[model samples]
Target: MSEIDRNQGLARQIAKNIQDSIMQGRLSAAQRLPSEVELAERFSVSQPTVREAMKILAAKKLIQSKRGPKGGVFVSPPSLDIAAQTLHETTNWLVSLGAVGLADIVGARRSLGRLSIAAACEHAEREDHKRIEAALLELDHTEISDEDFCRLEVEFHQAVAAACPNSLLRLVMVMVNEALIPAANMISFPFRQRDKVVAMQRQVFSAILVRDAAEAISAFDTLIDYQSGIYDIALEQRTLGSRLR
Candidate 1:
């Protein structure tokens, strides 16, 4: 019989070792973990101890279990909640540095985009492809002044980021897209300019539909470049107004 100190909340050491293995990619997403009997032997603990350790990992939302002939513990990829929390943490880190402006956020987003685009190209799913189409159709009919359009823009990007193979990278992409939607609407632009903004979204979505990752990424960059240009214009206006004052 295997020895185990059951009074303890499982073996913290055993749990940590398993957790570390997952984090270090010693185990990969969807990879099967050993059976309780196997794990008990490997960790030198009782089957109950291995069970406890698996529970700890499950509570973190890091691994999921299935049953049957094919049943076993498998690595859980990041869920939206996990992905979003990771992003929010990064955003908070930047905020700690000082007052981060729209331009600063945009720059960080562009740098992050390179990673997101690459991952999306590698892992986009069928439903994600549908998400792009749905977002675009909504935008196509949305009133120019509709806040719903802005919401769709954010939704579209979130879907795009989620398509990425790396859930962690999608997290920052979510934050950046969230950052952009509000800024995009804040400035008053000519009707033509607004149309251009809508057109660009369509362009990027189309690129994604075509499975052209390079074009999709470039389209996003062009959208940001335009936003940067507009932000600079807004700054110039503020400067002029201050001079008059």
Candidate 2:
């Protein structure tokens, strides 16, 4: 192998060893890793190779570097936000590339939405209720722009997802939002449809607030159906327009 390739292989091996240590509980969160020189000596590699390994770990969010007197590379705690952001970006890319279609996104959202509504109905706290209410109030603004309206709609659903106690479900919900919401927003929302959409959302909120899982799920399904109908109409119109040209 070339010198550069050999060094890269060593760097990956070192990074894997550190990842295993972290996963196996040998290294706890916030525990400072050994200095680069110490790691280079222990692993029998150059300091640059060890630095490459550190970069890999940092990119994966497995480690972080601090500056100053108390500064060093430290194990990073598991972060839901980082994980969710990563998933969101990947999902958006798939959607943009047409590797994932609107129907696929809608189906996934339906499955996940049912679970989220059920969990939120059972576990929603006072604070979660407050968030949903705040989003609802903003959505109810009479003269809201379509962009703001769409954004608040996503925020409202996110608030509902937050009410669910399962962290994994919440993370997946963010991915679903990234995949579906922007695509739906590309289709214009008529002013007449806005009232119906908000009304359906209100039904969902009321059902969840009362801890009525069945009702909440039903309302959510209805909203999904309406949105799917809108998407279908838009697709048909585009097809007809293409044929006319």
Candidate 3:
């Protein structure tokens, strides 16, 4: 039993080492790793232990394995899309597990929105403004459905966040925006409500265009506060209905 535990520990360690190599660019994406026998020899572990380590790495999307005459494990490339998706899923899990509440999500969205706006004031370029303007224009269309408006609203926020120079900050905004989807889907905006939201979005965008970070932040807060109030009311009604039943 002790020997088995030691072997398991070794496999985990090996996985970490390999993970580090891939992350640090020592192992390039699509580059094949050594065979299991070679890895075992190099690590001074049994072949089964090396295989176990490979399995661990494979599960993390750090590597992929193939079986045949010309197949071996290769480094999996890093992807912002995948990372954003993982963050979205993890956030949902936290909410489901009661580790995070709706209030926490709102708070995070506001804070991150402020930070991104500040960064954007410093870093936004002509192209970024164009992208944001296009998204903003979509909100003004009168014939669009409530669902389409909601989706475009998300896209508009994403365009604003993308103006920030920091990739990590942009990624965080992506996660926050995606996390709001499940709740956003629950509340359909009436025509008046949609118009109000579009007005707020225009204020935020105009502030951003002028590089007024403070105004942009203020407008964003207003938008978030309004949306939060609506969501809170929906949540309360949901809870009340559930209890009555």
Q: How many residue pairs clash in each candidate?
A: 0, 0, 0
Against the reference, the lDDT scores of all candidates come to 0.72, 0.90, 0.84
Model 2, span 102-152: residue lDDT tens = 788779989999999999999999999999999999999879998889898
Better of 1 and 3 by lDDT: 3
lDDT value for model 2 = 0.90
lDDT of 3 by residue, 39-137 (tens): 999999999999999989987778887779989888877777778888888887877777877778788888888998888777889999998899989
Ranking by lDDT: 2, 3, 1
Q: Is candidate 1 or candidate 2 better by TM-score?
A: 2
Worst 10-residue lDDT window for candidate 1 reads 183-192
Superposed by TM-score, candidate 1 places the C-alpha of residue 163 at a distance from the truth, in angstroms, of: 0.8
**RMSD for each of the candidates:** 8.0, 2.3, 4.1
- Among these predicted structures, which one has the highest TM-score? 2
Pitting candidate 1 against candidate 3, the one with the higher TM-score is 3
Candidate 2 matches the true fold with a TM-score of 0.89
How many Å off is the CA of 223 in candidate 3? 0.2
TM-score of each: 0.58, 0.89, 0.77
